[model samples]
Structures are given as C-alpha cells and as structure tokens.
Target: MTLDNQHWERISAYLSGDLSQDERNAFESWLQDSDSNRLLFQEARLVWESSRIKLRVKNPATEEELLKLRARIKSQQPAGRIIPLFRNSALLKIAASLTLVTVAAYFYWTLRDTETVIASGDQVLTLYLPDSSRVWLNTNSTLSYTEDFTKENRTVTLKGEAYFQVKRDTAHTFEVVTPATTAVVLGTSFNVNDADSATIVTVAEGKVRFAERDAAREKDVVLTPREQATFHHRKKTMDRSRSRDMKFAAWRRYKNVQYEKEVKNSGLYLATQYTWRKNQINQSVIEGTIRNSASLAVYRDIVLYVTYSQPGGPQKTSRLVIGETVNPGQTIDYRRRLLDIFTETNVLHVKVESAEVETGDHY
Candidate 1:
C-alpha cells in the first residue's frame, strides 16, 4: 500500500496520541476502511519508531569535522561497491527534515477539521452544531464534534457533562457518544454525565435510546420524558427509574434548586382508623384520612411506610404512595386492609412529601 504525505502524518499523530477527538474518530473510520489500511498504519508506526532515533542529533560536531567524517566514510567503501541511500549522511538529513514537516502538517490539518469548546470554570459555554442543535457545556467539560457535522451524520463526543438541545432531523439521527454510553435520538433535549464509572442520561423532552458501550453486558434502554437511566460499568447493568429532580440540567441558567424538607408536623394531616373484617381476628381494616392545610391549591404525594419485624430475622419496610391531588382544605379518605397476618399493627410510619404549588387556574 502507498500513502501520501497527509496520510503518513495522520498515522504519526495517531501513534503519538495527539489527534483531537473528532480526528481520532475519523482516523478510526479510515483504519476500518480496509485491511490494507491497518497494515499500512502498522508498517508506518514501525518505521516511525525506527526513524525517530535517527532523526535526533545524538552527536553534534563542527561543519569541518562533519565534512571530514562524510568524506572519510565515502573513501572507506570498496571500489564500485554501491552504498545504500540512508548510509549517506545527507540523505538522512533530508529524511529527518521530512519527518519534522510531517509532524507540523499533522497538527495544522487536525486543527482545521475539528472544533473544541472547553468550560474550565464556574460557567457554561453555548455551542451551535452544524445542524443547528444547541449545547450547553458545563464547567470543566468538553464537547467536540466535526466542523461539517451534518454532511453524513450528527455526532458529538463528550467528556465530563453537558446538556444538549438537539435539532430535529428525521433523516439523520443525533448521537452523543461518551466513554460509557451512546445516546441516540432524532431530536430532543437531554443531559449526559460521565460519572467516573457510569454514565447517567436524563431525558427532559421527547424520547432517547440509551445504549451501553465499552462494558461487559451490552444493553439498550429507552428513556422517555422525565425519565433517567444509569449505566453502571462494574455490574454491566442499566438501571431505569423515574427522575424526580427536574432541575438537574438547570445549572446552565444557574437556577437549580434542591428541594428543602418541610417540618414533619405541618402541611399534611394524617389520621388512621382500624376495623376487624367479618369477625375474623387475622384480618382487619385500617382507614386513613389525609387533609391539605394550605390555603393555596397544591399537589400532594403521600407515602405509607410500613415496617414489620420478621420472626427470628431482620426488620423489613415497604412503602406505597397515595397518588392523588388535593385542593385547599380538601380531605381524601383511603382504606387499607391489614391482610398480612404477620404485620404489627402499630409499626407504621406515614410520610408526606412536600406539596408542589399547583400551576394554572384552580377554577
């Protein structure tokens, strides 16, 4: 196989680990084009290793001494005996010059094809993709994609964390490729975080396909709006759950709010009543009442946590949410039957999560 100066330069930079993210991806694509390409890279790398030593000025001598050494070596060769090209010191100097040129050209060429944005402080950088997608790079994060992103596909390689507002393109899929996972979507908004050993993907709008990569178990998880999935590297598993924190990506606006705990005795009022069912001693009924005390209407979430001590074993706890909305001064009554014979009647805890302020008119 034959390679021009540009290809040789790229191989050299790749061997040196100097290629940018986009350039590395492009070089990998080139390497996969054919078997001959791989062989060429291997051969070029070997040649590079051997030639680097020759390129160095191990022993510096004055111009007169160098000329004397060159002429003396030429005279020692047998008459009519052909000397190889590299044995000639002048040819070696030319080859070293070409090597230096290749290194310089590689840096210049890679800079032209890739664009990088880095957020090094307590601020975010807004970037526009070739397809018009918007990205907010978090502090100490980086986002690198092709300068001509929309030509074939829209792909961005991220390090650290970033929130993306991708433009919709049904023809081309928008992809965020990280070290641990790859998220693919047509057009959506999401936040991706590389958490050392795992990758967390939170979907804010639309749907996304979160696929695990560079892990033991390959899995594909679909995340809907207000959903999150964490890909764990050690376990090689993907865990999906409802995302309670909506302001996870709000750091870009500096408006993130971590909820505060309300006083345990305020806001929600709980009452419980028990009854025996059909004169059966083992079965009983427990009636519960929850009242909203706030004057303004709010959405209330209630969790009934029950703890029971298993015989000769450890204690266990289970919780069930009372999914309902209550208006101001409204009361909702619920009935809970104690069907479990082993559950202690008095070992229960009622927890009321803070009520969210209702939006829209209450009328």
Candidate 2:
C-alpha cells in the first residue's frame, strides 16, 4: 500500500507495459512528486532495453519496445499510426493479462534475498561459486541458483547448455534440474544440454545418476565416465549412450581451433573483444581470418594455440573463448591468441607442399 520499495516495482511495471491506464496515471502523479521516481525509471530502462529478455517471449514483438515503444505511440498519436498501437485490441488484451504474471514473477524474484540468474548473453560466462566449484556457461545459456545454493544440496537449474567441473562433495550431492530430468553427481565434470523436450546429461569423470519423474512414470539411470543419458519427457523414457566425456566437454576449457570456412559477403575473420560495461561493448576489432569452405574440420583436441604481441608469457590469456557451441550464443575470449595461418607460427596451416586434408574429418 505504501510507495517505498514498491515504488520501483510500479515504475518497472509501467515500463514493461504491464500497468493499466488508471495505474499509469497514478504512476505519473507519483513521478511528478518525487525526483527519485524519475531516477528509478531510468534504472529500470536498462532492464527493459536489454535484448536478452526478448528470447523468452512466446510471440513475436509487434511494438517497438517497452518504454520506447510506448513513447513512440504517444509521440505519433496525432498521426494515428501510433494511436493504433495503444488501440490494438489484440495487444491490449495480451498485455493486460500477461503483465500481471511476468511482472509479478520478476518483482518477486528480484526482491528475494538469495538466488541469481547468470547468463553469458553472446559470450561464455565463467563462475566460481562459493563452494569452489567452477561452472562455465556457454553462450546463450542460463545458470541460476539460490545465493545459499551450496548450503543445501547444491541444486541448480540449467537452461540451454553449460559444462561443469564440480568440486567433489559426497556429503552434498550436486543436483542439476533441467526442463526434463535431474542429473545428480558427486564431484565431476560433465556437459548438460537441454534440447526442448529432452535433457542430455553427459558425464566425463566420476559418476552421475539421472532421475526422470512423472506422475505415471518414473525412471533412473546411472552413467559412468564417457557415458550419456538422454531423458525424454513426453514419452517418459530415457536413452543412454557412451561418449568421450572429456573430449566432448572440452569446450568448457575455452579451447578453439579456427579453420577454413567458405567466405560469404562478410569474408573477413572477425577479431573478438569484450567489456564489463552494461550498456555497450568497450572495444571491438577485426583480429583474425574468417575461414571459408576451403577449410575443413577445426581442432578436435582440447589444447590451445594462442599468440600475443606483448612480451607476456603463456601463463594466462587476456581473453578466453570457446571453440564449440554449447548453445545459441557466440563468444570470443579476451587476449585470445590464435595460431592461425595468418599467424606465422600456426602448425595446422597447410602450405603448398603440405599434405592436403582430403577429408575434413582427418584434421
């Protein structure tokens, strides 16, 4: 009932297009009275402006954006082009009904004392939890847990994909909950992929038990090193297979082997850069060659081939990028020195006398 912490929530709701006309009037009045109200709206704009939250949308976006879209409608009202946006019967019904659900959930989650949602966006995110366990989230994936995660059973939710090199704790089993099933491991490294209805749990070291729970059906499967268990939800069955766990999950190590992929309109190799800034990238430059169809397979090994102009040793790379795709995001590591053909020291480069790779797989 009071306008304290809830003030920010109201502003957020308004920015998200969840507030009704009457509620919008109330918010405007509140904003007029308090300077902080305007400031708070500015902060919420950051979240509303982000592109990450768009992926969760069930329908295509017809409006420009939350605040910006609504602003456009107001500015273009005289032209009627923007008035139709607010008058759109379909969008009004959808926004009014759906706003309560999403905004409420977002507000509650943000107010919670614990729990966090970590995502890499277009880059790979590295996390060192309180328990000393290391988690590498692939591009376009999410890893979330309560702030007191390790205190409990080490439970976490996985969306998209990630590779884990968990610290061994037999007393506290690490549980990964995907959309389909749960994968439990003692202390080991593994790769988990969520492909719609099925969850793929691949174990590289130690052992893991995957539990599939449903009202009418329940099953459990134990996987050893170099093994995988795929849990299908709709059919309520699990399929198990063997894989080279270490080799398969090597992407977690920030390894990459760039090769020849046919050039298209954008034929140049793109050099990757990163920044800690919230609104924009601090730096970006063209650093490497873009491969074309002439090149075949890239690196299958987990090793790294990096170069640097400075006199620094090979102890650490300024940037860290992965060679494989665990999900949809594409990330380039910082200070990534590639042993590329462009780089004179690359051993993989094929010279005129060098044997040609008849088959791409041979590389």
Candidate 3:
C-alpha cells in the first residue's frame, strides 16, 4: 500500500472536493480495493489536516538549478550506475523543492499525523474517525481531536458547527468540547453549533450530558432525544428546553428540498444533435438547444443529465453544467465536445435536470 506521487495527488484532489464525477468514482473504487489503501488515505488525510499548508509552492526552483542539482546527484553515484529518483531521498527532496512533487513527499513523510479537520468555503466534509465514529462538518467549521483519539479517550474540540454520530463504546465516553459548553455521551447522535453568541447542543438520538466546559458535574443537564441545551456566551448561563421543531438542523436539510423543488418546477426542453468525427481522435460533439417554456421564470446555472452508452451496453449518465442565462420563452444553444469516446457508442440522451430561477427578491 505504498502510494506513489500520482496516487497522492489523486488523494489530495479527493480531499479538496476538486475531482469530477468520473474521477471521484475511480478514486472511490481504488480506495475500496484494499484496507491498506484506505489506511494510507486516512493517514495522508491526517497530514493534510495538520499541515494546513497550500500544496502550491510560491517560489519554485528554475530549470537550470534543477539540472545542476541532478548533475550533482549523478556525480555522487558510481560510474555506469544510476539511482532511481524515488529510491534516493536526497534527490526526492531536491526535486520536491523545485516542483509540485513536494506535496507528495511532504504528506508521505508525515503520514502518521494530524488531529484536526476543517470544512472551509462551501464545502461540507464527512469524516470517519479512528474509532469509526462519523462527523459531518458544516461550512466554516473546525474539529480537532486529542492525540490518543480512540485509545485512552474519545474527545474532540469543535468550533463553528458539526454533527456527530458517536459509535457505541460503553467503556469510554465520547465528548465534544465547544467554546462555552461540553457535551458528553456514551453513544449518541447530536448537533453542536458554536458559531453564534451562544453554544447550542441539539440531540437527535440517544442521550447527552451538556454542561459548561469548566463547570462541575453537578451543574450538568441531562438531555434526551429531541432536547436542546443552549449556553450563553456573554452571560455564562445555560438553558434547557424541549425542541418542538428541527430548525437547528435546517442547514443540513434545506439543500435537498430546494433542489427537488427546482427540478420539479423547471420547464425546460432539450433537443440534442450528436456528431462523431472518426478522423479526429474519436471526438464526439453534442450540439443542444434548450428552450425555456415557462412564462414568468428566468433560469440560469442549468444542470443537464446526459446519458450515453455503447451499442448493446448499459447506459451511463453524467452531468453537464451550463451557466448561461435563458429568459422566459427564450432558447439557447450549447455545444459539448468529448474526446476518446468509445467507437461503439452510438446513443446520446440529454435532458434538463435542474436550474436556478431568478425571482428578483424571493421565491
């Protein structure tokens, strides 16, 4: 399970949510190929989280400098003998300093570490902990665990917002540390939000012990499913109440409902023309016209579901994003070019999946 530079690059891309659907599927298949692959990926992920360094080098060594370094390395070897670049650590380091290869080497060297995971920008990250616990981090959130993680203790510090599903380990208690509050449980699923002026803990399943981070155990409030506890930041006080609704977890549920509504209401028709150029690298070109039939709605960021298959083979679907705006009763034309399409592929199907409607102020 010794990963090469290319594997490391793919792992990095997967972590950053930069891989396309096809690449993601391939990487996931590779990950499931063996347990060692999964472990190596997890180790690299830890390093990635701990370093928090952008893989890009600000100032890279020039070509002449790289050549000189290589020449020096060759001079140290015996006559008529050459060492592989990967076999020599010194050469690897020298080359890493010169190019993007540094990212792979850096992670490889420190693969045994990190205790923090952050979900930045609009990325929502799902993490599988060492103890097999699950955590879903919302945007702009941070979660850090102790070095002993699942060994001697199961504790994690959280900032911003995160949802946790702790595995049942009767011998050890799971704990989540927020700025003002601490949530302790043997096994439970809960949401913790520390981003606002008050820290909020909402229990979705099982039970949790909620208290001030530094308060005595006597002050702890026991919360069951559908219960919530709020710790005020300024007043340093705690409030417990029964949750009548699931507003606390709305952030996790809103996206699906919104997307489904958009897809259901989208009144866009798609007509496609396919062309295969056998002489030019097996290029496949699809020209499509999208017509908006809605009378009052304007759409943008249209997502198209495309199905293609080789003759007598199973169909495969992929998504294409079109950012062009189409007004009510308007038609827009788009062309997509794909290279190296299978020579036997003769079927192409396209349809609008979803689109963002412009409602001016509100929808």
lDDT of each: 0.60, 0.50, 0.65
Clashing pairs in model 1, backbone N/Cα/C closer than 3 A: none
Superposition error at 79 for model 3 (Å): 71
TM-score of each: 0.42, 0.41, 0.41
* Winning model by lDDT: 3
Can you tell me which runs of candidate 1 are displaced by over 4 Å? 1-108, 111-113, 214-218, 255-363
Compared with the true structure, model 1 gives a TM-score of 0.42
Q: Please write out the lDDT profile of model 1 over residues 1-363, one tens digit for every residue.
A: 334444554566666666567666766776666555655564454233322111222232344433443343334333332112122243233334445344433434444445444553556666677788877777777676654468767877787888887889999999887765789999998899987889999998889999875322245788999899998878878899999886777565432111111223333444333332322565345566777654233455556655544346565655656667765457887766545565444444444444444443332
Model 3: lowest-lDDT 10 consecutive positions = 79-88
The digit string of per-residue lDDT tens for model 3 on 9-124 reads 55666665665676567667766665556555655654454333212323224445334433433343333311121232433333333333445444434333544445444666
lDDT of each residue in 1-363, candidate 2, tens digit only = 112223334555566567677666755665555444444453354234322222232322333233343343234223211011122343344344454335534533443445577877776666776778877777788887765567656877788888787888878988777755678888987788887888888886788888773212235788888788888878877788887443555454342223223112112223223322111231323233222222222321112233333233233223333343211112323323232223222112111111112222110
Q: In terms of TM-score, which candidate is strongest?
A: 1
RMSD of 1: 20.0
State how far residue 14 of model 1 sits from its true place (Å).
16
